[model samples]
Target: MEVNEMAAEECKAVLEHASLGRLGCSYENQPYVVPIHFAYDGGYLYVFSTSGQKVKWMRANPKVCVQTDEAQNQSEWISVIVNGQYEELPGPQYTAERKHASSLLAKRSHWWLSALGERQMRVGDKLIEPLFFRIRIHSMSGLRFTDEKERRG
Candidate 1:
């Protein structure tokens, strides 16, 4: 199918509302996939993580895939697969993106702490330092529930 045939608005909505996805990357020629919380800003996927093994692996290999899905029924579901490259946003971009990401965090009621309210972001004192990453979407493909039905409406 042609890329232009896909619904841009639908894909954007999926990225915005979906909170969890499996991020796929390879290390040492072996495949790895891990569940993560992500926020989308129309063009890129922002993921928050503390420094550790996963971050290290991603740094080594920037190219990755993010897959998210929602089931509407036993026979129907939609999934978006984003194939992109990850890069750590630096300097001014980092500052702005972090604030933007924080707003997204503040709006969500799914988690307990977030539901309670905003906490002070003490940059220097926090043990697990926050990192913001941008995944630049190179290409994406989605499967709709009606794909099998030849439905294009």
Candidate 2:
């Protein structure tokens, strides 16, 4: 297999097409990672989530990493990594931005279910208020791997 570095445009394309990724955050030297559903727009990756461990960790340390990939097989794959800072979108000052995030995320069917469902499971019969946040992309890099046969073809 041959591996090639993806250009900025190619990386953006991957982020635009992918809705799921692993979000990595660190607090006090301990690292945590979890699967997240996100929408990439402009220079940020928007996410809808409940107040939980991740939220607390991110609040303490805004630095984060997001990784997503598309794999056809062992010999063919595209992977992207985004390094960014987290920004919470709260009401009052961020009303407009929150609306924009909501619109973009709504395009993905059942986008809110997983977040809400997880929150419900954690706090049974309790009111679940979802929070919106965005990862301000600082940099992105990606790699594409293609089998030698495919490249030659």
Winning model by lDDT: 2
Candidate 2 stretches with Cα past 4 Å from truth are 109-111, 114-128, 150-153
Residues 1-153 of candidate 1 have per-residue lDDT tens digits of: 212234767877888888888999888998888887788886888876665667788899988999999876545678899999988865784798777876774455236234222332444435455577878988887777644343342
| Residue 47 in model 1: lDDT | 75
Estimate, for each residue in 1-153, the C-alpha lDDT of model 2 and write its tens digit: 788999999999999989989999999999999998899999999998877889999999999999999998777899999999999999799999988888888787264656587668877844456789999999999999999787456
Give the best candidate by TM-score: 2
Report the Cα lDDT for residue 97, model 2.
Answer: 91
> What TM-score does structure 2 among the candidates reach?
0.89
